[model samples]
Target chain A: MTEIATRDAYGKKLATLGEIYPEIVVLDADLSGSTKTEFFAKKFPQRFFNMGVAEQDLMGTAAGLAACGKTVFVSTFAIFATGRAWEPFRQSIAYPHLNVKICASHAGLSVGEDGASHQTVEDIAIIRAIPFVKVLVPSDGIETEQMVEFLAKDSGPCYLRLSRAKAPLVHEASYQFQIGRGHILKEGSTVCLFTAGFITSQVLAAALELSNQGVSTTVVNMSSIKPLDSKLVVAMAEKHQYLFSIEEHSIIGGLGSAIAETLVSSYPKKLVRLGINDEFGQSGSYQAVIDHYGLSTRGILESLKKELKL
Target chain B: MKKRSVAELEDLACELRILILKMVHHAQCGHTGGPLSCIDMLTALYFYEMNHDPENPHWENRDRFVLSAGHTAPALYACLIKAGYIPKDEMWGLRKLGSKLQGHPKLNVDWGIEMSTGSLGQGMSISNGMAMAARLDGKSYRVYSLESDGGAQEGMMWEGAMSAGYRHLDNRVALLDYNGIQIDGFVKDIKDVAPLDKKFEAFNWHTLVIDGHDMSAIVAALDEARLVKGKPTAIICKTIMGKGVSIFENKPKYHGVAPTDDEFKIAMQELGDQ
Candidate 1:
């Protein structure tokens, strides 16, 4: 099984797009190497702006460039990009609905060894509440590449969450990515497991384990969390007896809460949410953190079995 | 556009000041002091300095202006109306519900507002971006941003200052409305953002200090800004909190308050209005 980090894919895709879209400009706040915008900076130095540790300035500058008809993409750590510069993001970019792509890297507990200060578990909730801003969490490298290409051509504010750790490929190279859409990776009857970001790989492994135990399950990759595929969520709710949501972020405002909001409004179903239960992350290896948080394959399988009473 | 005489510019400033006072008084809410202090520069820019087409607000090659001290939107709205970007009838709708004239300037490109600004210290960074865009496209249009002494206290302002200076954004010109008053009290009494010119000079900007109400000085400083190369310029306009209106001048109480009916009559009278 091939593996690649979404941040790497973002850098490669942006460098490729820079060759095609002359209007595409990139800005980073002293984290180009970490966030992988350094690739574009190296290739297109004239178009890249190193804003230097000032997130507010980075966001406002991006808004200014976008207003002047430049397709601007800004990058930084999730905590600083969405937390430190939240007001500028809301007033300058999101309020005006500018064509700025905020592709923040090192999201969720996957940012291991950096501690809770670096991990942004509430970024999705904070960004999604802002009107006119689309939120996307691509499950794997292939989807991330396609999502970057899609956002480059699309206009308006978008927040794309990427992970630091690499994960197994969940989608084929020929997979077509669209904004506000989700994909079903597998089919089952008794239970449905919905996941996003790199955690989908674990959820897929859990589904395979459940099949061996004779518990039928379906796996749905809900990459687009903002303009959620409510139709597909409703269909899954109507078909499966139990629905489960898993993510590497806080359960409060991430994939779980998004699914709960849709199900409670349209199609009520028995659902279980699996994620960090309203707690901050600690410094540890990525796999150790996942195991401790019950996001590993074994932990997910055990949680599902307990929820399904099997 | 033909240049207006110093006396004519002063008269136009007085008229625009009256318009600002009336709009804020009718709305019953606005920053009275800063708008009054900054209106003269806005009038000069719109009426004389900038290369803009009010008939076509989104003209591609037009110069850009960002009001960093966005609480002064009343002044901007008055200038926009006087410059023909908006009609005089829309002045009544300032800060009203569903109005295009938001409390702070919203990005209504068709109305000639370049960027939505209200949060202090963010506008200069945006101005840098517009200047960089002009350089990228090899366009000759300039960018101007106006901020108050209170707004200069924000750290992001310094970040933008460093960036503009480092990048040598010669197309960008920033004006500081040095009114020395804020919502709480005098800027010196509160945070003390003094020696502003030296600070900007240290940041690699071509610095100028001028009497904000002097129309000739304002025009000359703007002219000097265009001649500057390899760096941005900062014009520190020393101004009273409320210029031209005697009752509100240098009054901190009027920083965020609207004029009462009696005060409005006094203000209009002071500005040589009915």
Candidate 2:
């Protein structure tokens, strides 16, 4: 199995698209190296703008370029991109529906050792509230490449959340990526596991373990957080006896909250959310944080066994 | 559009002042002083200086004007109407729901609005982007932005200031409306943004201080701005909080408030219906 960080894949894809699309420009808030936008910058120096640690200017300038009919990609840590300069993102870019894609890396707890200050667990909730902005969280490197390609051709404001750590390859070369849709990685009737982003690989491993223990489990990768596939969520709810939503973010306003909103509105069912409970992440290795928060395979299996009394 | 003479431009500015007062009085909710303070510069740009076609507003080579002080949209609206970009009848619809003349300038290039701006400090950066775009396309179209003192208080303004100065965007021009008043009170009392010209100078901008209400000085400053090279220009226009109407002039109370029916009559009398 191969592992590649989604940010690495995103940088390669964006640089490749620059050759195809002359109008594509990239902006970063002095984090090109960390965000992996250095690839695009190194290839097309004239088209890249290093905004010099000014996140507000990064967003505002991107909106400005997009206003002039340039497809702009802005990159920074998720904390700074969505939290520090949120107003600029909202007023300058999203409100105008500019052709700017905000590809923020180091999302959620995967930022590791950087602590709670850099880990943006509330980014999905914050960006989702803004109208005309599309939100996406790719499960692996392959899906990230496809999503970046899709966004280059699509015109409008979008937020693509990428992880700092390498993600296990969950999709094969033949796997197709679609926006506003969910992919069912496995099929079972007893329990349905809903997950997205870097946590999808962990959920899949847990599902396999649950199946071996005589608990029929299903796993669905929900990469599109905004414009979510409600139809698929409803269908899964009706088929499975127990449904769970998991993510590498806070349970308040991320994947768990989104799935709960969809379920209660159309198909009412019991939902158990597995993620960081209403608490901030602390400084630690990525694996340690996920394990303590019940995001690791062993922790997830133990929680499932306790819940199912198996 | 045909360029108007200095006397004609001044008359047009007075006419715009009257239009703006009426719009604010009717809307019963809008900024008054900021619009009056910046109306003359807008008039100078629209009637005399800018190379823009009202009929062909989206023309590739036309100069772009961004009203960074967007609470002053009433002034921009009046200029757009006079420029034949927007219908004269829309003046009555200012701040009304379902109207193109929003409380702030919205992005409607066809209406002669280059970009949407209400949040301050962002437009300067946006203007830099437009200027850079022209350089990339090898076009000579200039970008003008009207920003206010209150807006300059935002940290993003300096961010944009640093970028424009560092990039040496000579194609960009920023006109600061040093109106000396904000919603709180006198700008100096609330927070002094004094030495504004020197500040721009420090940021690598060619600085100018002019009487904002003087049509000749406004036109001369804009003309001088175009001659400079290797740097952007910031023309710091020292202006009254309100101009044209005596009752509202130099009064900080009128910064964000509209006039009453009785006060409106007084203002209309002061501005002269001619």
Share of reference contacts found in each model? 0.84, 0.61
Model 2 Cα displacement at A72 (Å)?
A: 0.3
Docking class of 1: high
Candidate 2 residues lying further than 4 Å off, grouped into runs, are none
Q: Write the per-residue lDDT of candidate 2 for residues A198-264, one digit (tens) a residue.
A: 9889899999999997989999999998889999999999999999988888888888899999999
Error of 2 at A199 (Å): 1.2
- Give the range of the ten consecutive residues with the poorest summed lDDT in model 2 chain A: A60-69
In candidate 1, residue A53 scores what lDDT?
A: 87
Off by over 4 Å in 1: none
Q: Write model 1 residue lDDT over A202-259, tens digit each, in one string.
A: 9999999998899889999999998999999999999998899988888888888999
DockQ top scorer: 1
- Residue A47 displacement (Å), model 2: 0.1
Docking class of 2: medium
Q: Please give me the DockQ of candidate 2 compared with the native complex.
A: 0.77
After superposition on all CA atoms, how large is the RMSD of candidate 1? 1.1
